[model samples]
Target: MADRIISGRTHDAYMTVRDHIADGWAASVCTVPKDAPKGEELIKLDTVFEREDVAWKSVERFARAELNNLK
Candidate 1:
């Protein structure tokens, strides 16, 4: 997967994608303040998918929606 960092006016979405032993792929989307430390973030979404493309799509969709909501 590629490195993706989605940013909003004051917040940013950081996505982590990894392989799942039981499932095919796992995706975690976290939102944090633009200038805050790494630990200062919230896990906005956590999902598992059967395909890498689908997992990435879901991550992008959720990240974009969260960023848009901040607008």
Candidate 2:
């Protein structure tokens, strides 16, 4: 299980968390990569949801503050 999460493969960033929610599970940010994706200085926070507002907002805040370094 550990081998899958940090296998150094490119992922859609927030898709794991979204999938967790969709499958009726609670999820939170565990880690984020610092290396920028190709040409971008910051990876886009491309998270969306129909429900799970609190969890989604928490992730958005965390991504903006911790990952993207945005105020």
Candidate 3:
């Protein structure tokens, strides 16, 4: 699957899904600072998931909630 990005005015949420070498799937969520240059800002890993669907849904929900909180 392709990476998903949720952009906000001052921040963006970057969602990445990948296949785990051991087994299952892995998903990660990172917050990007819009003001910083690419690769300059710190990216924090939120969580990992065993299922693709669950990871997608969780990231979407997290992005939405973060956007709402910013408002």
Error in Å for residue 68 of model 1: 0.7
Task: Report every candidate's CA lDDT.
Answer: 0.86, 0.40, 0.71
Ranking under lDDT, best-scoring first? 1, 3, 2
TM-score of 3: 0.69
TM-score of each: 0.88, 0.33, 0.69
Give per-residue lDDT, candidate 1, residue 1. 58
Model 3 lDDT, residue 20, Cα: 77
Candidate 1 matches the true fold with a TM-score of 0.88
Report the C-alpha lDDT of model 1 over 1-71, residue by residue, as the tens digit: 54478889988898878888887898989888887876877889888999888999999899999999987
- Tens-place lDDT per residue, model 2, 1-71, is 01112212432233234445354434344333534442333334344445565656656465434433421
Q: How accurate is candidate 1 locally (lDDT)?
A: 0.86
Of the candidates shown, which would achieve the greatest lDDT relative to the real structure? 1
